[model samples]
Target chain A: MSRVQAIELVYLFCAVCFIVALKGLSSPRSARLGNIIGAVGMTVAVGATFATPGLHRIGLIVVALVIGTAVGVPAARAVKMTAVPQMVAAFNGVGGGAAALVSLAEFDRGHASFGTAAAVLFSTLVGAVSFTGSAITFAKLQELMTGRPIVLPRQREINAALAVTALALVVWGLSDRSVTAAVLLALVAGVLGVLFVLPVGGADVPVVISLLNSFTGLAVAATGAALRTTLLIVAGTLVGASGTLLTRMMSQAMGRPLSSTLFGALTATASAAAAGPDDGADRSVRTGTVDDVAVLLAYAHRVVVVPGYGLAVAQAQHTIRELADLLESRGVEVVYGIHPVAGRMPGHMNVLLAEANVPYEQLREMDDVNPQFPLTDVVLVVGANDVVNPAARDSPGSPIYGMPILNVDEAKAVVFLKRSMRPGFAGIDNALLYDPKTTMLFGDAKDTLTSLVSAVKTA
Target chain B: MTETTLGLFTIFVLSVFVGFEVISKVSSVLHTPLMSGANAIHGVILIGSIVILGTGHGAVQGVLGFVAVVLATVNAVGGFVVTDRMLEMFKGRARK
Candidate 1:
């Protein structure tokens, strides 16, 4: 067999492995296996390339591998779970950047088809944008920068100009004097990337990251096309396709179009919380003991549990599930209310719950559960803040103005599990705390839920 | 330069780079926001692909451009859609 063909075969295996890895990642239980499968495939592909003809400079490659491992493994191992999304974004961006760089190198070495060069140019521009943008995104997510939406003065106009400039540079590159034009295009694209992300609110990072991951994959595919590498093409396409699908699912959960959010959403006018807690209408915030909450649940005919980031932080999913089971045994109906943007990423709550063996069917989206709130004898909110806050509906000037929220307040009795009365990710106080029907059971979520579960049994 | 070898070399080089990024978490902090922010790059891909389609290229090129446009659109629209939904969270309280 020709050496190139053999190498191709190895790449095909790697591509297959990437597909498997992606499939594994679809479910949390198999995500680790998926990662391993992808790694093994990549190893095989690399090994096969070593056997290719004219690859005599193997020493540099070996050194590169050694150095990469020395740096990568320890760094990945040391990252905290909260930083997982940031790590993924950076890695994805680098993948895109590397692909772009490789294609650029290939273009510079020789051969010129406007088509191929254009492809490479597009890839490089996007890849660089991804690299820098992801870096900034990581910073914001890590709280290195304020997680608030940073709106530069005249951001829209500046971004529009950058976009136009990038486009002009690309066209100029395609027509003549490609190198300088390409470099200019790259810079413009980089600036555009920064502007595009800077104005976005921090709450959207998960969806944004997933979307960018897809961008990186597509850039890699473009680079693959530039080089005519079948494996890179296939691997890139798989990632691109899967990432797009996931992003779509995430968008639908929020009941809005992605475009609306992209162009400086009107959310600030609509969904913000109640202004100043001293409005005095519902001044008396309800407070309760774990035992009181357990008693209320024990006697309730129906209970809906809403889990949020606090639940993830407290690692209370297992206990919450146990509490659900205990309620179910007494013939009380139970379900989980999952907000679209709960926790750090899309489906973050789902992932945690699934890990705790919570039944998938028990979880309901905001729209589905909102209607049922009035009939619910009890709505037990565990670590949820802004999504359920009534301020979105009542407070006109609040940051989260006009956004739809779960009707947790509609329930006959509402129980909140919280550490304190801190506002949610948006940093606004919720009026739900002071509702007449509401009761706050303050403590660590896991410990609180466990005690609530035990208290329910005796009640 | 009909250097097919160069293309092959690029693949290996890129693979190494990909492996490096995946293994190293030095830039872990940049992942999510970067991912979100970088998504606009897909629009560039979309625009480029559309431009190619409109330029009356070869049949093969046109077909390829069309596919790229489709894929790029999916990424662009899908990315924005998901991001918008997530952004909704900041507007209101996070419901449980």
Candidate 2:
């Protein structure tokens, strides 16, 4: 085959690899193999691009690749497990930035049809938004900024004005096909991106991150259209479609509509729960000791463990697993109730617990575990708040009213392992905390679970 | 260069459906890893960066292309490595 034909063949192979990679990743059996296949595809594609006829500045390109690997490899390696969400956001932001620059460079070269020019501007705008949006998301997750929704006065008008202005700039950039016009459009879009993400509550950040991932994919697809690269178009659209679907599914799992999550702040219905739970210092809660909790757990016929972000935050998944093992040894059945939003994102708890060597079969998803809670003798809630809040189902006027929750209140008794009575990521009050049947153990999750393990042994 | 926009548009549309169908049934437990893996796959934008760099003829475009190359490399390399690390725990004893 000719060189051009050979390159196209390799691109086709890379595309197939990506498809298989996704297919394998969705199942528990072949996730690692799928990732390896994707890497191989990436390596071959990069190598083939270097060999393309008429390629220039080979030395500089090699240097850039080396520098990128040097910076990226260490950061990915060193991040703690709990920080994986922010790390993913960091990588996503860079990808979006890259797509924008590629579109900008293509525009600067001054070779474009009107059709391609429009596509070029589209890529530049969306890519810039994705980059900045992902950066803000990273900041929120990393605690570099306040995770609560930040709404400025008259924010709705400002957001609308920005969108209209960005649209006008896109048209202006396309009419003349000037690089300066394209650059201006990118700047406006970047500001719009920050405002768009700033108002989303902390509980909804994962959905926004997924949406931004779709934006980057959309931007890359536009680059493909501008450059007439079929592979880029196909690959980019695949991610755009899948990312959009994933975002929808995640929001659904939380029982919140996707529109409300993204635009809720721009409208009047933003969660008033942003103030967080009211101070409950005057309200009495039955605080229990290790011995009391241990006796309760040991005597229970079936204990269900509910893990949330707190469990991940305190790095206590292993300790919790130890307590579960101790209970199981006494013929007390144990299962982990995993809320869909338990960690920072969907399926996040699975990763955290897997690291602690917890068995996969014992991890029960929300739907499966919800019906079983009534039969459960005791429900152990670890480092989680919003997912178990009864207001999600009972209080229609509550901020999280429509959201589905783990029916922990149905259990005979509830025990919470928490650091304090603070609100969860969504900053909403949980009425379940004050339920008379509920007992609170205020301390670090690891320390509490460690003490519970020892206490259960002596019980 | 000979291909029509209509043809490119067709591939893009078909790819979207295939994308939806491929991972539609993924269990919720694997959603985070699946999202990360998908994030890494789009790092294929690296190839687009390489192509742009090859087409760069001057200092400005060269530097633009260089930065694009570096950013895309971080995305592609960092994305895959992080995803691999996340999925690493799911093997060997993941099932038990």
Candidate 3:
């Protein structure tokens, strides 16, 4: 048995494990097993790589591994579920930076066949872009920067020019075999990456994060091509394809096009400012007390609870669960309506609710729950805004007019629990708040829900 | 294209189809975990980084390789662990 053959066999085994892992992830029942399988596959791949003949610098490798584990494990374990999206963004960024560094090192080793040069350039460009882009996304999600789209004068033209220059640099480097040009290419691409994500609004951050995840995958695949490793190629391409699909699905759930999400600054900012009460002072809104909302929930025959990013921010999932249980105890039906793009990421609301031991069966997707709103007695919207906005359907002038939203407006009565009269992340006021039958219960979500739970118990 | 490049391309193409097929079946409720899991899979680039670190020649290459190894390792480790933590919560929900 030759050493090279042994390594190939190990790679083949690792690849199969990854495939099975992904297959298991398609269902909730098998997701845990899928994770375990993937971890095992990664361990095997790393072990096999360690055994490659002539591999030296073992001590440094071990040191790096130790340091990484020390930082990575704790960061992963300690992160609150509310920050999972940002954590994912940060991790994805590091992966991309690592891919670019690998290519840089490879290029320094003097292996510059035209084909390899192209591969290295592609890897460096995409990797650098993904790294900077994901970092910006992480900052945005963490609220270190304003989540509003930050549009500069002539942003599109600048981005186009930067992209063109980066490409030109790549070509020049490839022809001249100059490492300096390659490094410059990476630097310019990094700038392009930052520019690409800076103008995306908070509401669109999830989709952008998913798209950047795909970018990291493509970068890794390019690294694989440069290294001539089939396993990396297979794994990277799988992630690339899946991440792209996920991004598409998220945008579709919002009923927005990808191009618009990447470039909707003009409309987004304008609509945000226009949708506020200051601009629409003529619009009338009705406010209610927590006691009133509790009575409404207690008397309802069937209630649908809509959760959103504000719900996560308030950490109100457990309190909301208690309130729902109290309602269910009084012979009221309670079901949760989950928007696909709710919270800060896709399926974010589900993770939060699941943490509170909410029944999986009671959590309904937007498509399934939208039709049931008419039959619903009270639609309790907890800390959500845009997803329930009627403007998505009724107001053509609204920026989110074409986006899909929860049909809470179709219910018999709607009760919104909000912090204030502020618009949602889209910076657009929700017409549903001013509907004749709507009642606004204003306060911090957890505090409001806590009061509601007790009120339901005593009522 | 050379035979090696062609082989890589073939793998890339086939993997795309497989990824789409496998991921399309995932329910919307698990999309977060799906994204996180896929994030970890791309951490396979750690192998490339480690290879560079082990075989790198000069001090500059060594430093670059070392940083790459560290970053890629964190990506792979953190991604898998966090995903597993998330999936564990889902599993708990399913059992009840």
Give the alpha carbon lDDT tens digit for every residue of B1-96 in model 1: 457645655654564444333322111112232233224222223323333334323555444444444444433333333333322322212112
Docking class of 3: medium
A1-459 per-residue lDDT for model 2 (tens digits): 899889989989988988888888876668889989988988988998987889988888999999999988899899898798888888888888888999899888896888788888999999999999999999999889988778887887897898888888878887878888889889988998899899887767888988888888889889988888877888788889888888887676444679978876666444553455343422346577776678678767789999999898999988999999888887788999998888899998999999999998999989999999999989999999999999889999888998999999999999999999999988997778887678888999999999999977865
What TM-score does candidate 1 get on C-alpha atoms?
A: 0.54
User: Per-candidate DockQ versus the true complex?
Assistant: 0.04, 0.53, 0.53
The alpha-carbon lDDT assigned to residue A37 of candidate 2 equals 94
1 versus 2: better TM-score goes to: 2
Model 1 regions lying over 4 Å from their true place: A254-256, A265-459, B1-96
Residue-level lDDT of model 3, residues A56-75, one tens digit each, is 99899989988988999999
Pairs that collide, model 3: none
- Angstrom error of the Cα, residue B77, model 2: value is 0.6
Sort by lDDT, best first: what order? 3, 2, 1
lDDT of each: 0.63, 0.85, 0.85
Across B1-96, the per-residue lDDT of candidate 2 in tens digits comes to: 445888988899899998898878654446677778878888888888988888688987888889999998998898899999988765543123
Model 3 error, position A214 (Å): 0.8
CAPRI category for model 2 = medium
Clashes in each model (backbone N, CA, C under 3 Å)? 29, 0, 0
